[model samples]
Target: MPEIRNILFVMYDQLRHDYMSCAGHPTMRTPNFDRLAAKGVRFTQAYVQSPVCGASRMSYYTGRYVGSHGAAWNGYPLKVGEATMGDHLRKLGMDSWLLGKTHMTPDTEGMARLGLTRDSVIGARVAECGFDLWVREDGLNPEGPDGFYYATPSPYNEYLKSLGYPGENPWHDNANAGVDEDGSVASGWLMKNARKGANVKEEHSETPWLTDRCLDFLASPQAAERPWLAHLSYIKPHWPYIAPEPYASMYGPQDVVPANRTEAEREDPQPVYGAFMNNLIGKAFSRDEVRSEVVPAYMGLIAQCDDQFGRLLDHLESTGRMEDTMIVLTADHGDYMGDHWMGEKDLFHDCSVRVPLIIYDPRQSAGSTRGTTCDALVESIDLTATFIEAAGGEVPEHVVEGRSLMPFLRGDTPAEWRDVAISEYDYSCSVMAGKLGVAPKDAVLFMIFDGRWKMMHAEGGFRPMLFDTLNDPKELDDRGDDPACAETRARLMERLSAWSRRVSQRTTISSDQIIARRGKARSKGVYLGVYDENDLTPELLVPITGAAKGDFR
Candidate 1:
């Protein structure tokens, strides 16, 4: 059994847990993802700490909850002092490199306050959410009223231009938006444009391009190290949801699954949930015409993503590195796709929060778990601990809040594990919060799911939301306000409260350090700290008793 020498952490943006055929998707077939699952463990109950991009990725990178990391939304900066997976792996002589998106917003304010310059190596790494960038691209280069979404030129756009897709922003034309016969941009953001294929060559698409970039990195001399973590983050199966060539027409509206919504859900919805349902984006998804036009494109993007995964997998096998590297396929978060009448992922619904987690660990110890499914509750942040442990590094419990899945990968169930999966969202940074008249701090929501029951707690004096997922598998029913479910709601709330009060901030020091310093004050001649002479050594007590004052002096 060779030790797991490297990590290929592949993440797709807005990929739902059930979209893969292996996860029981009735229409979408992701054979490549299924292959990975067959070769390793597929987690049935994996969730992210937050359902949005930046905050969720930060939680995965830092192994901390959103509250602990203090990054509540996309573009929110992860604080400077928090330790990330890169920081942990580096301590064990492994380098963590980023090949694509991290969705990380640099802590510019923290950097300025601490006098950290981005030009410095430490500063650069800090700015990248603790990764050494090997071609960093957040992938979305959408032009808006304020210029591009990122307000900077994209390297991908430059690459597209080099490939003869001439324009200042080919990212919008060839990569994202489709081009009409009149050469006008068919913006993918529009539902009607989803019916058309992207104008880019299939090979030049973002998914394939990012895969090539990863392959190039692997072939590079610098990546010859036996141990490294390469985060191959792809921006796809996300919005601007057009696919290229064959993928565009691969799935039709006929394959689109019916949305998990009902008039019953709309009636007497919780205040926060109601606000999201009425959000502009949510309203768009609520229309049947929009869903009919957009869902096929969404499916096409995922199919393309799966095809790219196959390419990467084939490359690894061809290079004979497949047996040595651990491959983890997951997503930052899941898209709502009109589920619960939502367009994006800003809620705690399963479609929005749960994500597919397939881990292919080639170690001999993982043989028993191969092709097996683990139903244990897990979080996206758990990958940090799993990676550290797989690399033969100690799991820093104080710094990382997630439990390692190494035991499950080794075909062993943990003696005890978390019964519930938690997710959070802070909508204050979103337009929906303003429309709802809720303050930033009060606009936050937390979800706790114990498999059977899912509970949502919103701040700002909003009502709680409860779902008996065992009965309403689609989460169509809200039992939070039901008088019959009062006891169930209270119990779940207690669990959430307990989880929130955990010792999350004692990250700099371990419990062993505190224990080691238990009686140090008395040993340092602080006599008041000791209740009796036995509490201190005789030599120390003699000096403290003034019996050997001259010697002590």
Candidate 2:
């Protein structure tokens, strides 16, 4: 195979597959991503191996499952020595340039020490990756001058403020107004915007600049000759639930409001797991003052991302770089977006795990397969293999789990492709699932989605919940107890069991050991959070003083 010249990867922070036009989303309009899908292979059923941001990203970058790498959750570091895609690509003589957030913590000092006020992505232990350049932040969200909906000012926070919002805003808290089928808003104040269309292009906002920087890097002479890799990670559609005018009103709250819960759904046994229900949103918005306008603003935010993405694509095409470049557009994971009464992405349901995965192979096809959606199961881990293979490099022998999607991207699905995809979480293992019956014990919840059959096996609370996704796409009903679905459940369980064993072998950290090592770190006053494997949010954690790093562990 000939060497591929350039690799362009665009990963959104928290994007849901159902929100993309190419993924059967009739209401959302993402022309650029949609266009890419038209010409390339679209994995209709793509899921993150790990549900959260850091863990899922680790899986993709390392070509290993999250369980294999010890960075099980956010705020945690990957084991001291792990080979990343950047490392492997560099070995093949590729000049890797990371444009935006990589989510990896730079050093033990954390964000504050690296000239970062918030969680910016920095690859501290990425020495082996051999990236030529990394324009990274510690966390995924970029702080603008305007600050987030309810945040204070800082280097990153000021970026949000410059966009024209109060200096202290926390849009991430909860502003999801529950939308009814008839288009009436019931819960959030996302619509509480003083100025809309006029300020969308505010200079301080980071999205525009992130794109600009990426373009600048792409245009550089070095990129053309070295076969560079650039990951344009955008922070839009992630929070504040506010959008500039016109777009804020582009889709009326009534126009874009998707399916809601029914009375029967309210009574769902798996209510805790359902998406787009009042029970979920109610948690975020009990105050009536700011409830009704949240959805509209949130919709507008997504439109902004789509628009920026289009601009980036246009620039690539205009520069004559679109044809030779291999573009992969997807997200780290999905967001609940007021679904099932939830606001962020820290769950195991499709709302948090299934994301849009579009691979555009400019060398092989372009606009050749418009509207073609492949239903094959694909996980984020495959990306490492796909990129290596696409760049005419060898897939690392250490990463044995991921299957390259190149064959499928070329419209060839080998007979051995797996039919099911699995995801997991280990944060609340002891509380959610019983401690694995072993020393230094931990619990885990494993999920398997195979076509219409979806099984969630927990260690404790719920032994296992099964859903026929086709019959109940919303997953309102649990068929685990129904005798008729026994065979289906059994088949899924077998897969789950096999996956469980595989994960066991791949387990990177023993809960006891992490606590011990982290305990010393925490005593020194470093803010720490434990992200669950399935859910990125810290389940059980302690905040150490942001005091000196040496003061703590």
Top candidate (TM-score): 1
Relative to the true structure, candidate 2 reaches a TM of 0.74
lDDT of 1 by residue, 169-232 (tens): 8988778888777989888877788878898889999998998999899998768854799999
For model 1 the local lDDT of residue 34 reads 96
**CA-lDDT, candidates in order:** 0.89, 0.63
TM-score of decoy 1 = 0.96
Q: Could you list the CA RMSD of all candidates, in the order they appear?
A: 2.1, 15.1
Question: Per-residue CA lDDT of candidate 2, range 276-332, in tens?
Answer: 233434455332333345555555666677777788788888988877888888999
- What TM-score fits each model? 0.96, 0.74
lDDT of 1 at 277: 90
User: Could you tally the backbone clashes for each prediction?
Assistant: 0, 58
Q: Lowest summed lDDT over 10 consecutive residues: which window, candidate 1? A: 544-553
CA lDDT, candidate 1, residue 5: 84
- For model 1, what is the error of residue 516's alpha carbon versus the real structure, in angstroms, after optimal superposition? 1.5
